[model samples]
Target: MSSISLPLGGDVRKTRQNSLTLLINRFGVFFMILVLSGVGLIVSPGFFSSTNLLNILNAVSYLGIVAAGIAFVIFCGQYGDMSAPMTMAISGVISVEFMRYGLVPAFLAAMATGLVIGAVNGYIVGKFRANAIIWTLAMNFILEGLVRWSYKGTQIYPDMATEKTYQTGFFLPLLAKLDRHIMDIDLVSRAQAFNGLATTYPLGVPLVLYVMFAVMIIGYIVMSKTTFGNQLRVVGSSYEVGRMSGINATGTVMKAFMMSSLFASIAGIFMTSLNRVGAFYIGQGYDFQAVTAIILGGMSLSGGRGSMIGVFGGVFTLGLISNILTLVGIGTFTQKMITGFLFIVVVAVNARSLRKLGRDYA
Candidate 1:
């Protein structure tokens, strides 16, 4: 007996289509990055220099962490975390304030604050089916007000706290005698842990740079290899279908929100440490920046499709643009306008592409 075989034309056509899509997804952002890099090299004097390049990488590291967290929520087909900035601010302030007691205590306090906030957000948005954007944004404002009221719009500077004459108001003045270098930006800067180093050696990179890459690697693994990732994808693809398939859609979404907020907390801790000061506005504007980075990476706001590598490329591209603008003598206001314009263009193009795909499917 002879076995039946499917038609070759359909299979061949599908193979070609898949190949094209894969090519487009993998290379689209990278191509833009390359083009921007070339333009930088041609237009800017020191665009290709080691110093400038390292600067770009260092800057990208910070945004990369935040974007990674945001990507987690997007993976689960959730709205962006509008509370990320507040989460960062609160965590940083708590960490900085508690630093006077002990490193262990302060770090715990910070992480605990973050986890608690994450849980709240996760429960509200995921379990209760609250509006992610509106609820999170409301939470952001509440936290902001609370922080300002507690801190009195002041900053916590570790370096200044050490000096006897440099006394400042503390929520807990009793435990304000410990001298830990947790917020010592100078030491960290010299060590090049989280910040990109000015010096260059292929092997001699910063610890923070490694940390960013580690986050990306972990994100990629979680999204691509794990069972939770599969559930998230399924839920994101279709909530009703995922439920019918017996996937715990609510729990998965909650986990995604919790994880995203957790990452935001981490970003806050790093920001506070780097700045050597904990202010109410430490992570301001990062939420939108992360969103922009996600969109630039070609992830759908509707969720269920994206890659970590593309996110990295998106971050690097943004960093490159900022660096290039600064080098070319653009003012802060002008840079903001330019960034806004670029964001609008990218979003429009992405929306158009998505619509076209929808029509094709229809």
Candidate 2:
């Protein structure tokens, strides 16, 4: 009698699905990037020229920094930071306004602003268990209102003079050094070397682009190579499990929030320098957009998975889409709509892929 060989049909199907998903996960974004680049070249002449490519990188550079920080928060299973836009705007304002003291001082002050905000956010959310989404939204609104009120609904320019009569008397002299021409717009303009942060192109590469790359690389190292990164992944997987494992779950969460805020502040500072002005409205739409980028990069909103490289791809994809759309004469508002639609589609595809791998929605 001869024996017939048999195969487990279900196992074979699952093996095939697992391989498919793995392949998609590894190369899908780059493949899409290539496709989008092709579309750009077809639709927009010279879209991939060195100058224009640099332009795309520069345009998304600050936002990429913001997304890098937000990625940590998402990886830790917390919601996105809504206060990021304001963090960037306010920090930039601080940098520009404090430039009279010196570049180092102004930069430090801007950093301090971010540090304080991030600390407060971390403590409140991580310790008190405040809802991250609502709390961050509140912070965002509070910052927006405070900035608007303080500036009297006007933009703060490096060269713009402060009102001396009413409110300026108190703080201006307190912060300004003993110089008669401290209020002189020309002197202030000359002093604001901070603009170099955004303007300087090293080796013909935009400084902000370098900053983005640096931040992303650091984040990658932290997440992939550090013990803290491992702890963060454990915490993201399950806070209770993390606690059981003797991890500082609260501190880990706090650090994640702080990281996000700090990154946003950096982006904010550069953006302000680029515009040569600081306004509450600066960096608007960054929070949602950053979240979108994180999701697009293959990070689960439920946390415990993602890579900085993937996050950058997500950021680059968005920039590519925007460039291609612009080349095809798509209006800004319509581009937003199209991007929104794309976001939904990508999210759905990611979810489907995960399901095929026999994973839950987390």
Candidate 3:
């Protein structure tokens, strides 16, 4: 009899608490960010300084851009493109080499090549339902070997300071004056633009930071507001269900892959410009780095859940850790170890949560 009367609204109160817990769990990246920021401040007073923050943003912007692209594939339920790093590597190398022709041509060539690679990956994966990770890994190795062979196992140093001297007039006299004028203005101006890709600071902010944020904003809009985004979400959730609902699942996934490729290539250009060189190793570890960022950003490995804001949080979190570690004198090797450790922990937790929900951890 005493137990027969329950408190009024107790179930409602429990529901409210559950909702709060879910929100906390879902947005835990931001909370971790706050915690990490506090830790950074405690460890290094300069962690939040304008100069240091700008450096952090600059350092992570390339990865952030790459991560934003790879997130699309993750969103589409593709594990990831293992070839992303190589996409960046080859694209950067090509851009630098193409500069001999002209900067505009170089930029176009880099972007075009990246899209071609992405289109191939998307088509093969979508048409055959092949294992995306394995296929892309193979592609990565193949591209690596080609790059090494092409460059004779050396890094391609960009000629940022000089353009290739042209030999005109003798071979083609009719076009001499126009060619001379065209080549003269064309090479230097576009090269300046190319260098500015990474160097220009809008209001003392690295141009790459602006680019990274812009990509994130566009990505968010595409994923949240558009019809294709809706289809992508449905397809990501369940390909069969999406197909049944008249969605072009394969095409949708293909676009995601292409977007990822384009993003990687973009990162490649900036990174190459920053380093002033391109080589097989230019983007060596970006593949897993991007996935880690997206995953830690509150996205599930199995796909169909994430946000650009969450991805940005994840990217900043990694950079913050690096800056803090550097302030505390941790070297790059140790930093890698710490990062790899964190990645393992996050994936494990994600898998556990998925298991609890009786979901596939694909």
Candidate 4:
């Protein structure tokens, strides 16, 4: 009877306040996308075309795949993976070389190569406790050197002629008879529509875009709907806490790196498919691009928070900006400068938000 009613405490209030704060924090990236879209549409007429829109999607497709995969690693609190581009290039080269055997064989071989590279990244970063940035950078240099030495600084072009001939032998008749129109509209009748529309499959766009989309979706599901994803989040939040929770922190980080490398390799394959060529320098600086897309998607650089959808949005935004600049006939240097500036701005905003979150949590 002497036990009095418990009072509502400050800690409870603080917890409620933080919950609201976190909800708002998560929306910053999405809001930024809306704001950018509005500004872009208002400023540029060319930004809204079906063709231009498809082009943006096509252009962003491979990068989006890479960014989606790497977003997990960043979310896992790894500093960065510099070996992404290298992994891509190596996989591309392997895929091109294996094409002489057959498409299926070639693709499988390329994926295998990617897996190996991913394993290597994971081993170094996880087992050795190496600095992610430095380790990945060194691995990148090694890969580049190997590629350069093997190719003697030359580019390897996929045998499109052979590919066409093979297609003609097997797929030509089927493709020729396929319906092109969608809903009686000629807009989706084009080859590009196969990238998303359910009608006729475009020879190149279908394979590349569909693969990229599939990868993105899978990555999204893995990061958001799985036990592994939860483990990654915990590890990213704090290695010490994660370890105390009986999660293998190093293993989680390694898995993230592996996934990142695997995605990069897939991106490389798409690039080769699109370009019909593999260059030693292919995917140059794409690691940074992936990082930029991840950050712009609203992922915290400090780690443990991001989504595949956000990465896709960020990739779309970047592609839109780049395409608009090109359509306007902006010079290469000017476009790079503008893009770089925008990247800096977006990243700065995200960084500020992350800092605020840390302070609030503290």
Q: lDDT of all the models against the reference?
A: 0.74, 0.82, 0.81, 0.71
Where does candidate 1 clash, by residue pair? 193-208
lDDT of 3 at 229: 82
Question: What are the per-residue Cα lDDT tens digits for candidate 1 across 1-362?
Answer: 23576655444333233565657655578888888888898887678888788778888786788889888787676758899998998888877666544556666788788778877887787777787889989999999988887667777665454444224443444343453443443433332332222123456565557768888899899988999989988887676787789998788887887777777877787788777677888888889888888878877777787877888888888898888778778886887788778888887876676565442210
- Candidate 2's C-alpha runs over 4 A off are 1-17, 162-173, 176-186, 189-192
User: Compared with the true structure, what per-residue lDDT tens digits does model 2 show for residues 183-268?
Assistant: 55463545457777788888989888888999999999999999999998998877789878999888998889888988998899
Q: Which ten residues in a row have the lowest lDDT in candidate 2?
A: 163-172
Clashes of each: 1, 1, 0, 0
Work out the TM-score per prediction: 0.82, 0.89, 0.85, 0.79
Instruction: Write down the worst ten-residue block by lDDT for model 4.
Output: 187-196
Error of 4 at 63 (Å): 0.6
Ranking by lDDT: 2, 3, 1, 4
Specify the poorest-scoring 10-residue window by lDDT in model 1. 190-199
Winner on TM-score between 1 and 2 is 2
lDDT of 2: 0.82
Misplaced by over 4 Å in model 3 are: 1-17, 100-102, 160-193
Residue-level lDDT tens digits of model 3 in 32-117: 88998999989987778889888888889999999999998988888898999999998898787566566677778788878888
RMSD of every candidate to native, in Å, equals 6.1, 3.9, 6.1, 9.7
Candidate 4 local lDDT, 1-362, one digit each (tens) = 43565655523333233765576566556676677667667767666767767778877777887887788888888867888888888888777655544557666877788878877888777767788889889999999988777666767655333223222222222433462321232322221321122222466454557877898899989998999999998888777789899998878887898788888888887666655566667788788888887777767777777778878877877787777677667886897687678778866766675555543220
- The C-alpha stretches of model 1 lying farther than 4 A from their native spots are 1-22, 159-204, 359-362
Highest lDDT, which number?
2
